[model samples]
Target: MLKASSDAEALRSFLMGYQNTSLTYQTYLKELERLVLWCAHVQKISISDITSDDITAYQQFLMLPEPKALWCGNKRSKRLKSGEVNPDWRPFASELSPTSIKKTMSILDSFFNYLVQTQYLKGNPLSVNKRRKKRTQPQTIERWLEKTEINTVLEALSEMTEPQADAFSIIRAKYIIHTLFYTGLRLSELTNHRMGDFTLIEGAWYLKVIGKGEKPRNIVVVDEYLDALTEFRKAIDCPGLPAFNEKMPLIPMQDKLNPIKQRRIDQILKWTFEAGARRYETLANQEIEEGPKHLRRASKLRKASAHWLRHSYGTYLVKSGCPIEKVKTLMGHSDISTTMIYVHIATNDLLDSAQGLSLQEED
Candidate 1:
C-alpha cells in the first residue's frame, strides 16, 4: 500500500508488498533506506545501478568512525567519562555497528534478490565473494557474576526504604534479573511475551516463544522458573483472568494494564542501580576497556544484560557435558557451525586435544 518516489522507495514498496506483518520488515525498510542514502553519498548513483563493490566500500566506511557519544547513564545520572563519540555523525554511517552492518547487508541482499525475481535487475552484484578478516582465536575469559556479587545485588534490593522500597517493585526487579540470568531469553523476546505463551503441562512449565522468522519454538521450564512464574502470577492475580485472552501481557507495566515495554525495562534497571547495586548500574555504559591487560573485577552490570545470560547458558551447556549438537537444538541455532563457538569454551572434554600442542620456538 506504500508508494515509492525513488529507486530505494520502489524497492521498499516491493518489500512491503510481500508478507510484511512482522517487526523485521520495518527493520529491513530502515536498513534499506540507510543503504540507499549511503550509496547516494558515496557513489552518487541510483539504486538500480549499484554494484557489489559499492556495498563493500560502504562497509569499509562504517568501521572507520567511532560510535555516538550518548552519556551512558548511571543511577544518579553520573557521567562516566569515555572517549569521544564517533566523528562520522552522518545519518547513514553514524548509526551502523558491526551487528547493524551485518543486518543491513542481509536486508539489502534480500531486496536485491527480490529485484532479480521481478526481473527488474539482470543479476545480483552483491553475490560476489569477499574475504572477511580472521580475528584471533578467542580465549575463555571469566565473565559471570560471583556468588557474593549476586548476593550483593539482592541485598541492595532488600535494603531499600519507604516509598522507593515497594515490595512489588523490588520483586519485579529481582524476577527480571533472575529470569534473564536463568532463562537466557533475549530482551525483546522476554518483553514481547504474553500470558498465553506459557503453559503448565503435567506439572512442567514451557515457554512458547515466537523467535526469529516468527517460528514457534517450545522451551522447557525448570523448577526455579516455575517458582518465579507462580510468584509473579500470584502477585498479578492470575487466577481471575480469562484463560485464552491473547491481550494479557505476561509482564504488565507497573500500574498499567498494558505489557511492559523496553522503557519500563530501562527504568527498572535504573532503579536497581539507584538501590546501591553499583555494579549492576553500569550495564548501559559497558564497552571494550583499553588498558594494560589484567584480571578486572567482573562487572555484574555487564554480566546481567540479556545476551550475557544466553551466552552463559551456551557456555554452561558446554561445560556441563552436554553434546554440542544437543546444545544447538536447545539454543535454537539454525546452523551447527554457528553453535561451535560454545564448543571452544567448554574446557573439560577438550583436555586431550590441548595435550597435543607443543610450543618450542625455533632457536
Candidate 2:
C-alpha cells in the first residue's frame, strides 16, 4: 500500500490529467479525499489497499454517520490550494439519496479504472459488480413557495429594520429574493448577471441571463420587481437604473465589489427562511389549531431556500393557464417533459401524496 498522501497525490494527478473545468475538478477532488481518509482511518490502510468490504463499510457510514456534529460544518472551503486535501471535511453532508450514492460509487469506479490502466495498482477493488441500489424517477415538486407564504416573506423583508452597519446585507437579501421570485431565474443565472445585463427593449425592460448551457435568455422585467431593483440600486448610491455597460458585481459582498459566490446565496436564504419560518409559525398558530395542518407547509418553507422562488414562478405560470410550451421556453428547459412536471404540480395537488408510484428521495 502506498502512503496516504502519496496515493491521494497520484489520484489527483490522474483526475487533473483529464483537464476538467474548475467545478468538475473540485467535485472529484473532494470525492477522492473522502476515499483516502476512509482508507486511512477506518480500514487502517492506504487508498490503494482498500477492498470491497471496506467499500461496504464506507457506504454504511454515509447512511448514519456517527458523531454527526463533527461530520457537519459550514459548507465553505477551508483549504483552497489545488491538490491539497482536507480529510476532515465530510463527503456526504447528509444521507445520500440513491441517485447521489450511485454517482459517488461510479466516480470511485472510474478512479480505480484510471489507476489500473496506469499500472498504479494490480487490481480495482471497485471493479466487481456491487449492485448499486436502483433509483426511481423523482417526483417533481420542484420546490415551490405558496402564494401566501411568498407574500408573507416579501412583507417580512419589507418590514425588517436593522442598524446602519447591517443595512446593506439585509437590503441585498431582500432584492435577491424578490428578483428570483419575479423572474424565475435559477440561482446560477441570477448570480452571473452583471449590471449591464439590464436593457430597455422598445417599451418594456429585460434582463439577459446565461442559462443552462451558456445560452443567453432574455427575461422580461415585471413592473413590481423592477421597482424593487431600482430601489436597491438607489440605496447603493447607483442611478435608478444601472449605468450603461457597468462592470460591478450584481450582489457584492457587504460593501466589497465582488460577485457573491453561489453558496453565499444559499447561506443568505437559509437565515431569511429561518426568520420567515418564525413569522409563518406565528401566523399559523393564530388562524389554525391543528398541530399538523399548516405546519407541514410552513415546515417545508422553513427548509426551502432560493431555489423555491424559481419553482414558485414556474408553478404560478402553470396555474395561470400558460401554455406548457411557453413555460418550457421561459424556464429554459430543452425538453418539454421537464416543463410538463409543473403542470402536474398545478393540476394534481389532491393526488400528489400517492403519485409517482415509486418511493424516491429528491436529489
Candidate 3:
C-alpha cells in the first residue's frame, strides 16, 4: 500500500518499488513523467495541485493532441553531412497514433488502480465503472510475412556457410523462429522456455507460456518444429545443465562480449538481415520511394521484428481451417477480440460455408 498527498509524490513512491521487476520500469516511469509535466503545464499549478479532473483532462489531451498547429519533435536528417534543419523549429504536430495513445492510457489506468489499492488516492478517475461516452474499437492492423516470404527466409538461413556461421547458433535461431511460427509464443515466454517446458502429448508437441499479466497458457508445436528443436539440442550438446542444459543458454550469441538478453535476440535479427534476408532492404527502399503507406507496404515481410512471426502464425492458422477460439489459446491472447484481428479468412472459404448452409436449407 502507498500513501502520498500529491501526484508527483505518489508517482515517486509507485516507481520506487518497481525497480526490481523485469518490466520496463524506466520507460513506464518516463511516460508517467510526461503526463505529469503536461498536467502541470495545463493547470499552471504545482504537481502537488493535481486533482482527478487533471488526470482526466490529461488522458483526453493524450488521445487528442492540441488541434492548433504545434511543433513536432526534432526530426533527423538523412545524410551524415547534411546537418539538421533548424533544431529549434518544430514541424506541424501530428496526432499521436491511436495505438500509441491507447497503450499510454492503459498505463495510466493501471497506475491509478495501483494508487487506489495502496490507499494513496481516494478514487480512480480512469475507473471503467464510471459512465463514459462511446469509444471506438481499437484499430486492428498487423504486419505478417507471406507464406512464400517465410519460406524464402528459412531457405536463406539454411544456406549459411561455416566459419562465418556456427551450425549450433544458426540452428537455434532458426528453431526459435519456427517455434514462434508454430507456437505463437510471446517474446518473454519464448525466452523463459526450457527444454523441459516441451511435452509430447499423444505424439504432438506443446509448450507452456506465461503470457501478459502472468497468465499461463499452452501452445501447440508442429512436428517440423519438434524435429528442428531436437536437431538443435543435439548440435549444442552442452553438459551439466538440467532440462536440455537449462542452466546453459539455449542460443548464446557469437558476439557475447556480454550476457544474453532481449537485445541479443535483436542482434540475432540483424544477423538475419546480413544473411541474405531481403525484408529490411526492401522496406528501406520502399519507404524512400513510396510516400507514407500501410504496414505491409512500409515494412518488409521477412525483416519484421520478432513479434511479427507470431502475427504470421496467427494469421496463417486462422486463414487455414483452425477455429478462432483455438487460435486465441495458441497465441496466449486473453481476449477473443485481440485474436479477431488476425483472422483474415478468404472470401472463397466464406462462400463455401454459405453454399453449405444453402444446401442444408434446400434439403
Estimated TM-score per prediction? 0.70, 0.71, 0.65
lDDT of 3 by residue, 214-282 (tens): 667877767677677677656666432225324333344443222356556666765664453454345
Greater lDDT among 1 and 3 belongs to 3
lDDT tens per residue, model 1, 244-299: 53556766766536878664776776566444345434432454352111113333
Clashing pairs in 2: none
Assess each prediction's global lDDT (C-alpha) against the native.
Answer: 0.62, 0.73, 0.63
Give lDDT tens digits, candidate 2, residues 1-363: 423257767776777654534444556777787777667666689887777777778777767665676565556555556756565555555665443566678778888887777777888877654555456575567468888777766666666777422778778888888888888987777777788888887878888776764666788788888899899988888788876777777677765478998878888887777667767777678877753655666687777867679888888888888888888878887778767768766556667766776777877
lDDT of 2: 0.73
Which residue runs does candidate 1 get wrong by more than 4 Å?
Answer: 1-5, 17-21, 40-45, 64-100, 130-155, 162-166, 237-247, 270-295, 298-304, 348-363
Candidate 2 segments whose C-alpha is farther than 4 A from its true place: 1-10, 14-20, 43-60, 76-93, 97-138, 163-165, 183-193, 199-224, 289-294, 320-343, 346-363
Model 3 weakest 10-residue run by lDDT: 239-248
Arranged by lDDT, best first: 2, 3, 1
RMSD of candidate 1 to the truth, in angstroms, is 8.1
